[model samples]
Structures are given as structure tokens and as C-alpha cells.
Target chain A: MADTTWLTLAPAFLLGLTGLLVLYVDSIGRSTKGPIAVLSLLGSLAVAGVAIALPDALGLGPAGWSFVSFTLLGMFALALFVQPGSQNRRLIAGLSTAGAVGALGVAAAFLFTFDGEPVNPFGDALVVDGMSLLFAVIVASVTAMVTVASYNYIAEHSYQAEYYALVLLAGTGMTLMASANSLVTVFVALELASLPSYALVAFLKENKGSVEAGLKYFLVGALSSAVFAYGVSLVYGATGSLQLTAVQNAITGEFTGMLGMGVVMVVGGIAFKTASVPFHFWAPEAYEGAPAPISAFLSSASKAAGFVIAFRVFTEAFLQVSESAGEFLVLGADWVLVFQILAVVTMTLGNLAAVTQDKVKRMLAYSSVGHAGYVLMSLAALSGGGATATAKIEAGQFVLAGGMMHLFVYGFMNTGAFLFIALAEYWDVGRTFEDFTGLGRQAPVASVAMTVFMFSLAGLPPFGGFLSKYLLFGATVNSGFVWLAAVAIVNSAVSLYYYSKLVKALWFDERPDDKKPLEISSRPVGLYAAVIFAAVVTTAMYGVFGPVSDAAIEAAAALL
Target chain B: MAVDTSYYLILSAAVFCTGLFGILTRRNALLFLMSVELMLNAANINLVAFSQYYGNLTGQVFALFTMALAAAEVAVGIGIILVLYRNFEDVDVAEAATMRW
Candidate 1:
């Protein structure tokens, strides 16, 4: 009921501050981890600050419980972090995990506290709204999961502080990306998210795959950003302003060529980030080569950020461009037609490519691409672009909300799937689909979690993925994009075949003779914790689907 | 009178094209990095030119941000390239082709 606008920034602030603190401590010495964790304990409680700051907030129920549990979690962290020995791996991991989880808690808290009104605390540079808060929760949740999984995944690696710091930093950038209201902020926030990602992908400096993938990812990323900057210039040239609302106000069909080209180029740049087809070549290689936890971070949290920018730019910045286009919106049409084409191609190509992959990571990478297509359709479904009618616009928000909910679901299931990979990698389980044979018998609990992930990703019933995809497609259809929905449904069917392949290998196939056994690394507690946490949330999504759906609707409606 | 905005755009376009060609043809990582810089600077020229033409400081300010982005990109780019050379024993991007591109 209160303003809670500045409280919206708590998550970004906590993660970013923790990132700097971790790096500075790592520079000083190894024993600093315990202190870092204890210090961040205060930062974590910044979430409870929502309860403490707002009147009658303690009566809100969850706030009081969250505060109590947060304190307990800090105590638990203290017990683990202060353990003896230099290069205290637990300490750094604990610090990062604590920081990320704190960010997640704050984001979740803000979701309830935000009054659903758009607040531009920083002029047109940034807007903190329900949509941004929702994205912050997604990013922070994924970051928390990644940091938790990285506890084990990164032990053998050095630069522990740098890795965690970059993860947190990139997350800060990503949350900012969702809030960016102008072209300049969007570009800057994008680069902020991307630069660290390039580094994180190459974090395994000695590994040839990591370094090579890093190079490829960096080259592609640099080129796309250059393209994005050019598009911004063209748009500025035409409209004389970079602010989203101002751009919409300035739309008058003058410099249509510049506007059109800039819009397409900007979309192209976003495609690169989302790893949609044409710019998706790097995604498979990067996911395959990078540390699996980092892969999950990029695929889940970072990709959501990419879609957030695309949604904001088109719907908010170019809202007027569509209505101003004259005649049927997509008949002979505008960039909306281009989005329709992209939505179909990206989904189909992603699913088809996913089928041919033997490596589990690479397969998931392609599937990651497929999911992007589904979300892109939300933007494609945007109130039929040029319709001045209020009902048409509301229908547009429905589909957009569907996409947001899908991303929320994705933030869980996809991250869970990739964390399973990290668990496998940590256990030295072999890489191919064939290697996954008989893992079911090896780690039944984790395997079941993974089965949930696979089935969920394939959009099977009784899982979160099914409901989210259903909502997305249904909204698209209801919005009068029947053909688009048809293509997506077929693509969805094709996707099932590949997603099930891993499930088949997990439970059905027999281990090859003389294969290194899964029991070698008995249990990675961090991995199990992260994977199971994701699995629980993803499965619980079904039960809580109503609230999430309504929240997403509210968020999208606010944007429109 | 100064050069026209159209001419500045033309020059930037030429520069951007050259950079794209370089990145495409030259396998050397350093050359590739240089090419990316060229493309970013091309965006810079456009921003500055449009700033004067549109009579707004936003474009001019944005041009500076582009420069900063380019610098940060180059920093990361060169670091990755350095790693590439170390592992592959060559700076050639194509040399590290263990995976299918």
C-alpha cells in the first residue's frame, strides 16, 4: 500500500555491493570470507527493511517470517564460513550464495510491496515498475541458484572472488536492463550485462573449450552491440530523443526509413542476446564450453533480461509507431510482421537443431533457443501493433503477461536442468547422452528432479511448463494470431522429442561397459541443494499458477 | 560551412563496412578487435553528426557513452584474445576450431 519505490532497488544494490566487497576481500586475503558473510548478513536483512520501513508491515505475515528465517540463514552461514584453513572455499561460496539469495529475497519482497504504479525515480533513465521487479526476482533467483551450484562446481578453479563478483555484477546489470526506460540506458545496461558474461564464459582460462567459446561469444557479442549502438544512433537521428515515451511522442512517419531500419537493427541486436536463430551460433558453443552453472546463469537469467529489453523497447518506445503505420497492422506491414517471421523461424530452428545434438549441454542450448521463440511471440502478439482500440490493447497485454510468466517458469526449470548438468559435471559423469545412461539408478533423488525438469521443459501436463506455454499460446490465439499459435504448437510438439531424449537416457538406457561410475563423487551438497531448490519451485509453480498469472497480468498491464 | 550530416553518415557507413569486412576476412584476433572498434566509432560519428543536425546534446552525450562502451569491450576482447593465443599457440581465431562453428 506504501510507495516502496526505492525499496525496489534494494536487490541490485545488495548484489552489486556484495560483488565489490568480495573482490576487495579476495585482494586483501583469504580469511576475509567470514567477515564478508557476516557483513552481508546486514545487506540481506535489507529485504526485511521493507517490513521495518513500512507501517503495519509486520502484520503482512511473510515479512515477519522472512526476517526470522533470514536471521537463521545468516547464523547457518556463519557456522559454515568460519571453518578453518586459508582459501576457505566455503567462505567465498557462502558469501556469494548469501548475497545472491538476499537479492532474490528482496526482489520477492518488492513484488508484494510495489503499488503497481510506474515510478521514474531517475528521470527517464530508469523506471521501477511491477515488470522490472518481476524480472529482478527472476534474475536474482537464477543468480542465487547459480552461486549455490557453483559452490562445488568452482572449487577446483581459482579466482573464486572474481567469478562470484562477475556473476553478481552481471545480475545487477540484468536487473537494471529490465528497468531501463531509454535507449541509452538500455544499451549501457546491456553492455554491463554482456561484458561480464564474456568473462564468465571464459573463466576457465586454461580450458581450450572455455577460452575458444569465450572468444567466439565475445566476437559475436561485440559485433551485435556495435549493431545495437548504430541502431540507437539512427533512431536518435530520426527522433532526436532516446527516451521511450519521448520516442513514441515523436513518431510522425517522418524519417520512416531511419525509424524502420533502426527498429529492425535493434531487434537484431536483441536477437543476439536472446540467442535466437541467426545470432544463436554462439549459444550452443558457449553453453557447451563454459562451466555448467555459468551456462545456467546465461541461459536463464541473462536471456530473460534480453527479452525484457525487447519487450520494453517495442511496446513502450515504439508503441505509437504501430498505430501510426496506417491500414492493417501486419497485412503488408510493419516490423510487427518481421517479429511474426522471427517468432516462427527461431522456435522451429531451435527445436530442430536440438534434435541432432548428442551432448546434453548443447542440446539444452538449442532448446534454450526454442524457448526464446515462444517468448518472442508475446511481443509479436502485441495488441496487433497498430490497433487504437482498448480491447485489442488489453489482449496484447494478456499475451505479454503470458510470456513473462513463461520466463518466470523458465527461470526455474531451465536452470534446474542445467544445474543437473553441473551436478553431472561435478561428479565426472561423462558428457554425451550415452554417458547419462543409468544415472537414474545412481542418484535417484537428483535424477527425479531432472526428470521433472525435462518433462516440464517439454511442456508436459502437471508441470509448470505446460501451464505457462498454454497461457502463452492461448493468449496469442485469443489475440487473433491463430497462425502464429499453430506454428508454435507444432514447434512445441517437435520440442518434446528432444527434451525426452535425455529423460530416456536417464532412466531407460544402460551404462556402457567400463564407463566411469557416477558414484565416484558421492554427493555434491551444493549442487543437490541448488537443483532440488529449482525443482521444488518449478513443480510448485502449478499450485501457485493462479497468483503468478495474475501478477504477470498486472505487470504487463502496467507496461501497456 | 562545415561538412554536411549526410557526408558524415556516408563516411561512417564506409568505415563500418570496412570494419565488417576486416572482421570477416582477417582471422587474427587483434585484427578482429580492431574491426569491432571501427564499427563502434562509426556509431560514434553518427551520434555526433546527428547531435548537431538535431540541435540536441543527448546524441553528443550518447556518443561519449559509445566510446566508453567500445573501450570496455576492447578491454574484455583483448583479454579473451590473449587467452586464445595462449591455449592455441596462435592468435588465429580459426585455429581453435575443435568445435563445429
Candidate 2:
């Protein structure tokens, strides 16, 4: 751990390498589809198999199993999309190769990272630990799914290599964001993640909706990042350092007005990234208009990256300091109350807006915002400082872990829902509740997968979402924020109404009599595989909740 | 004599507000990008001023980084605006709103 171990950097490098290779091969106009497909199949199988078998040999314990699960799931998703005979065979082959390579990166991340032992590869500027790797798993897995699904989603599109390369690049950026421990790294990584995403959102340049969504997304993103940069400068002015630990030590007494402004601006910037209230405007338009897999990627993986930074900065830089002595709660209580209010308003507004939406995509967008509110509970729970940082750590770990676990679970269930949309889009199945009618009879398997996603997203009992939601609220109550927990519970109940609408539309409603659709063409193999893979993870998460929760709690403990 | 840090702070604040005003008032997509650049540069000024004040290179280095990042953002922004104009036949952001905000 002390030596300069470059082992941890391999995963991100591999992803970037694959992305470049795809672009290079495409530029050179090589039709290496047969070999590419063969290599991807063999590579995915080998990585998955090797990771599963080596966990015991290497004594990775529970963490190894976690790594194995990611590898297996990623390979399984890739395995499904390996079929041949598509018009965009080279595109599909190249993308699948990139995805399998991404999975290989996840395996590398797991192999290098051990449980309870955090690795700092580039000093404190970057960390290779439970929190970062957990997020890496989420981002990389979602990227894998998106790459596979986009095989069909953008099948005939001309810029196939660019599409996959941008995705892998963005995935690399999100992974870096999780590990960034300095403001400089954080800012750079944010842009690295976002720039490619703008192009991806507007990938379908011919479509006005896609173009418009990209413009709005770019405008908002540029504005927010400027705000964020100014905020970082303010913090630097107040504290005289960019490092989190230095900033933590610098914030000794009451927050100066400068520091206060810095904190608010910083939070504002992060809010836009997570699609929270007041900054969530682009989410609906972007998600509704862009190809659905990108929507899935941004909502699940990108959002998790934002929260990981929030967790890191607040814990390492802000929350650890301001310890109280005897009389009362101290400097830690200030921004926390602000966070609490934001959480309540964001969750409530997101759900209420979702209820009024007629378009399913827009509704999912708002629900993503609502879920952001739920994850915000982690920050909200660090309400007061203890006598020492250790005391604060103890008080915050359970509640913080709740949000972490929720994000982990949310990554699966939410991505599944959006990928279902991708599947429907692939079929040119119409949008909206009515459009979904009788389609359940058409594609029973994908519909059932969608049902699992909806049920899980609604936090129904016996589903994966329920456990994570329960843990989040339960920890909030334990943190003495019973009111926050109450609001969250009520929101969950209201959310059920909308989530079930999709189910009812799929099953109970009759297909419209007048418009008889033509017979279907060949199946969208990639979309179905990705959707089902997500669905399987959504359900299968239940069996391994114990290890997942432990890992999340362990991860949160390091930051707190 | 070196000017006080507060003077630089005030200058940057004024620049930031002006940029914010342009963003609020302008409809042109290119103008919006220009406004964002002004805002980002306002931060760059703060960073460079703070580095001088703190006697450290971190802020100065980040300022350099900020410059690069701004240029990169502008490049992406221009590409997006070009597409917007191609699709909507206008560079105004208002014209680009096919979906209800």
C-alpha cells in the first residue's frame, strides 16, 4: 500500500484504452467484426470466470464476492448481445468489445481493492477504496449496459465509434470523480465526465428534440460549473489550500461569510449535477429526447458520482472538523439544516411534479430527482458534530451508509427502468401510458422485466428498493430526524401511485382497436439483454443485501 | 504599492454580476456562451489574485487549468450551438425549446 502501486489505475486506463482502440479501428476502416466479436466473447467469459474463481484463492473475502458479482453480471449482459447479422456489425462488435473491457476494468478494481483497507495511489488526491470502487462498479456496470444496449439503440447511426468512445470516456470521468480528493481534481473530473455527455445527448443532431435538449443541457451545465469554480476559488481564499484535509483543518471556528458562500455555491453546483430541484430543468427534456440508454447512464451512474464527491468533501473536509466540547452542537449544524430543507423540498417537488406528468420519460426524470432527494439524506444526517471527529463518524456512519446503499440499489433498479424504455424505443413502440397498452402481450419477457423495475422503484415489499429505502429512512430516524423520515415515507407512498400506472397500462388496459400495428421485425437483442440484466440484478440484489450493506457501511466509515 | 485584495474581489464580483445579467437577458446562444466565459474568468481572476495573496502556486495553477477548461467548454458549446442553429434556424436559446421547460 505504501509503494506507488499503479495497479489501481488499470481499470480506468483499460476503459480509455478500449475507447481509443474503437475510434482508431473505425477511423482506419477495418471490418474486423468476426475477430472483435470472438475476442469480446472470450474476453468477457475469461474475466468473469477468472474473477469468480480467484476470489477464494486470493482471500478477498466478502469484497471479492462483491467483485465477482459485478464481473459475472457485466459478462452476462455482454454475452447476450454477441449475436451476429446486424447492419451495424462492426459498430456492435466494437461496442461490445469496449463493454467487455469495461467489465475487465471492474474486475481489476475489485482485485486490487481489499475490504477495510483503503488504497491511496496518488497520495490523497486520489483514493482507491470501498467508496470509490463501489461507485466504479456502478458507473462501469451502467456504462457496460449502455454500450451493449446502444448496439441496437443507435444501430444504424453513423457515428457509432464516437458514441461508444464518448460513453467510455464519460464512464472514465465518473470513476475519476469518485476518487478525486482535491478541488482541482474534482473540477477537472466533473468536466471530463460532463463534456462528452453533452455531445452524447445531442448525438442525434438531425432530430430537433435531441439538438434542443443538448443545448439546454450544455447551457445549464456550463452555468453551474462556472458557479462551482467560483465557489472553489472562494473556499481557497478562505482556507488557503485546495486539499480536503487542509481545508478541514483550516475551518476551525465559525464559518466566515466567505466560507459560507463557498459552501452554498459548491452545493449548488453539485445540485445541478444530480438533477435536484431548481436545477433539474434539463433532466426531463434531455431524458425524454435523448436515446434512453444515455438517460439510464446519466440518471444512475452520473448521479452516484456526484453524491460520492458530496460524501467525500463533506466528510473529509467539512464534517470531520467542528467538534463540540460540552454544551451544544457546533459549526457542523449550519449547512446541515440547509441540506435537510433541500432534501425535503426536492423529494416532495420531484414526486409531485412526476404525478402531474403525462409522459413516462419525463416522469422517470422527476423520479430520478426525487431519488436524489432520498440520497441527500446522507448529507442531511450529519446534523450535529460530536465531541470529536470520531464521535461524528460514529453518529453519521449508519445514516450515511443508508444513502450509499440506496444509491447502490438505485443504480440497478433505475437503470433497469430506463433501459426498458430503451427496449421500447428500439421497437419503435409508441411512448406514453396508452402506447404501452397491450405491448405487454407482445413482449412478455421485457414487460415482466419492466414490472420488476417498476415494483422495485416503487419500493414495494419483497423488492430490492424496499430494503434500501427502509434502511435510509430508518437511519434518518435513528439520527433523530423523524420528520425527515416521515416525509420520505409519505413520498414513497405517493410514488407508488405513479409507478403502478406503468404496470396497469402494461397489463390491464386494452390495445386500441382502430390502429392495428404491422407485424414486428427481428428482435432487438442488445436492448433486451441489457434490460433483463438490470432486472435480474434488481431482483438478485435481495439475496446479497447483507454483503452489499456491509460494504456500503464500510465505505461510508472511511469517509466519515 | 500593491492594491488590497478586496479591490480585486470587488472587480471580480462586478464581472460576475455583469455576466449573470447577460445570461439572464440574452436570448442568443452564442451570447450565453460568452456570458458563461465571463463568469468563469471572474473565478480565474479570484484564483490568480488569491494565489498572489496566499503566496502559493495552487491557486495560480488552478487558474491556468480554469483557462484551459473554459476554452474546452467553449469548443463544445459552439458545436452544440451550431447544431441548434442547423435544427431551429436560429442561435437564440428560446427558439431551441421544443420541449416545455
Clash number for every model?
A: 0, 0
Q: A474-542 in candidate 2: lDDT tens per residue?
A: 888877778888999999989999999989988888877765652456578888888888889889887
Give the per-residue lDDT digits (tens) of candidate 1, residues A1-560: 54444555778768876775565455335454556555555555666565556645546544344445455443544343322222656777788888888988888887877788787754678888888888999999999999999988887777787788789889989999999999999999999899999999998989999999899999899989998999899888888899988987787778888888788779879999999866888999999899999999999999999999988888777774232443223211276778888888999899999999999999999999999999999988875533455656678889999999999999999999999999988888878998998999888999999999999999998899999999999999989899999999998888899888898999998777877666754788899999999999888886778976887899888766
TM-score of each: 0.89, 0.88
- Candidate 2: regions farther than 4 A off: A1-4, A30-88, A91-115, A321-333, A384-392, A513-519
Worst-scoring 10-residue span by lDDT in model 2 chain A: A324-333
Once model 2 is optimally superposed onto the true structure by TM-score, how far is the C-alpha of residue A202 displaced, in angstroms? 0.5
lDDT of 1 at B91: 88
Off by over 4 Å in 1: A1-5, A30-86, A321-333, A383-388, A514-517
* Best prediction by TM-score: 1
* Cα error of candidate 1 at position A426, Å: 0.7
